[model samples]
Target: MHKHSYIFITFLSIIGLLVSSCQQQTAQSDEPQQTATPKDSTEQLVLLLSPDQMKTIDLDTTSLKQTTIRKNMLLMGKVSVSPTHLTSLSSVVGGHIKTLHIIPGQRFSKGQVLATIADMQVIQLQQDYLTAKADWTSVKENFERQQTLNAQQATSDKNLQLARAEFQKLNATVHALEQKLRLLHIDPTTLQADNIRQTIQIYAPFSGTVNKVFVNTGQYVTPTDIICELIDPRGFILQLNTFEKNLPGLQNGQKIAAYTNDNPKAKSTATIINRVSSLDDDGAGIIYATLDQPNPTWVTGTYVNADVAVNNYIVNSLPQRSVVSFENKQYVFVKTGESSFQLHAVDIGESSDGRVEIRNPAQLADMPIVQKGAYDLLMAMKNKPEE
Candidate 1:
């Protein structure tokens, strides 16, 4: 009985230890677990307000002032030669080209001999004139004798009158022949000195350079045949063709500035001397403008740009970026009330550099316009409005 009691006490002690360990494990299992909450998802998205939105949200109505507007017209044109300044040279009569005294690009003074003509017709005319002159001299002597005889009653009045009439007729014929020789370009003084043996000489009508030469030695030439083209490079005029729609703004004496890519440093000013009344075959308008300034760098047939200043008028203007094109129409984001933007359609005018003229200024007087980030604002506005 004592051995059994001892073994039972030891088993009771082991059971008590097992029960305390289980109580401690249950307390650990029932303890509250600490879990971290996820961060707010709303903080990850950043709302970016575009320039249009900012203008609508932050525009100050009290500080806005009325803007002065200026209207201008822009036109594109090309440089050309004035038709009035261009000239063509041709022979006055038919003949064989004896010599070419001047070559292309050579300068000549007015009345300078360009070439000589060995014309058989001119030679025959000269011969006839000489013979007529000799006959006229003899006839004048006879007429004087006949008049003297008539006064003395040594010859009949009829014979004396006949001699005098013949003499006068011969004299008139000789004078006519002299004029004809002069028209033929024969120098009367030279002809008289050399007994009319010199070949006819062709002279330039104006002082200019020979731009073209058509005849060589021993070539046949006529009045219709072109001998050369003369141009006075010293007095050059620039011709420009402009659009017809811009014709109303263009007037005589309007100033224009011109330049070329090759000669950017050199600038020339021209005046609108004339405008073409006709339109091109395509129905586009055209105007002819001229510049009197001499430009050696400007060659005929060379194309150049011209800037013509049209009259200026008042207009409302804004930064070019403020305007956006949508569906072939232009619009600007304007402040409607507070922190909100609305798209407003606007008519655009002349634009240059970074500014554009607005046609209707009254519509924008009380509204805030988006000057920066306008395009971004437009893209954002295209989305559904926040509920």
Candidate 2:
């Protein structure tokens, strides 16, 4: 009986030790859980501040100053042939192209021969013209003699009148022959029976580079056929298309800067020489803006960008972050005084870079606008009531 009692006591002592260890572990777990509750509560109670409340917290202000403002509008444009420099060459007579005196890209002066055309019809016309000139000369001599004889009564009045009429008719025939020869590309002074030519020489009407040559040696050509195209490099214009909404600010003589994609660093100032009133079929519009100077780097058909200056308006300007939008309305926090802020409505205008035009009379010129810590102040103002 004594041995069994001793064994029972040993078992009870072991159970008591295990229970104490379990209680110590439970207390340790509860202590950390209790500390975490306060931390979670503090995290949930976040504060949000309005613009006015933000301005009340140690805000800064500055005096406003008047400054010149300029408005700039950017537009895309392209290089095009100036209307003044574009010319088309057409053949005056139908014939086989005998020879091309000038190739494409060759420069020629006014009245210079560019090509020659050989036509059977031109040969016949030249022959007729030569014969008419000879006949007209003979008739003129006879008429002069008849006039002298009529004054002396050496010849009958009827005979004198007949000679005079014949002379006038021959003169008209000579004029017609000259015109026909000219149309056939024959110089009147170079016309003679032995020197008569069938090939008509086409002359350059203007001094410019030949941009296009449509005919080769031995090619057949007609009077209506386009022979060549002349382009004067000296005459160049920048053609730019702009939006219709920007039309009101655009006018002839307005200054603009043009730059090309290839040479962006090189800029040229041009004037608005023309504006088209029509809009394109698409909702997108177009306006013609011409440049003042001819830039050699500006190639025809190359695209460019243009910046045009428009009218300037006065407004209170501030950093872009100073004003924030909420619920479709714009608001700015104005510093009423030290440790005070008031919400003010403002009309905004043109914005560029980091600055925005603020149209408000609340004297924002010298006031310190919340630039860096606006969002933080906003949160503070929202939680001020709860605090």
Worst lDDT window (10 residues) for model 1?
57-66
Write the residue-wise lDDT of candidate 2 on 1-387 in tens digits: 999999999999999999999999999978854333444543322333456755665544433334335567788868777777887887767899888888876778888999888889888888877788888899999999999999999999999989999999889988987887777667887877888777888887776677888888898988788888887666667777766656767787889898977788888888877776677876455555556666755557778988787765344577667666644666566555545455555687667656677666465656656655444445555556542
lDDT of 1 by residue, 313-346 (tens): 3446778888888668897777555455666678
Model 1 bad stretches (over 4 Å)? 1-85, 101-107, 138-168, 193-195, 232-239, 280-283, 293-297, 312-333, 341-387
Model 1 Cα RMSD, Å?
14.5
lDDT of each: 0.71, 0.72
List candidate 2 stretches off by more than 4 Å. Answer: 1-68, 82-85, 101-113, 180-185, 265-269, 280-283, 291-293, 311-387
- RMSD to true structure for each model, in Å: 14.5, 9.8
- Position 152, candidate 2: lDDT: 97
Q: All candidates' TM-scores?
A: 0.60, 0.62
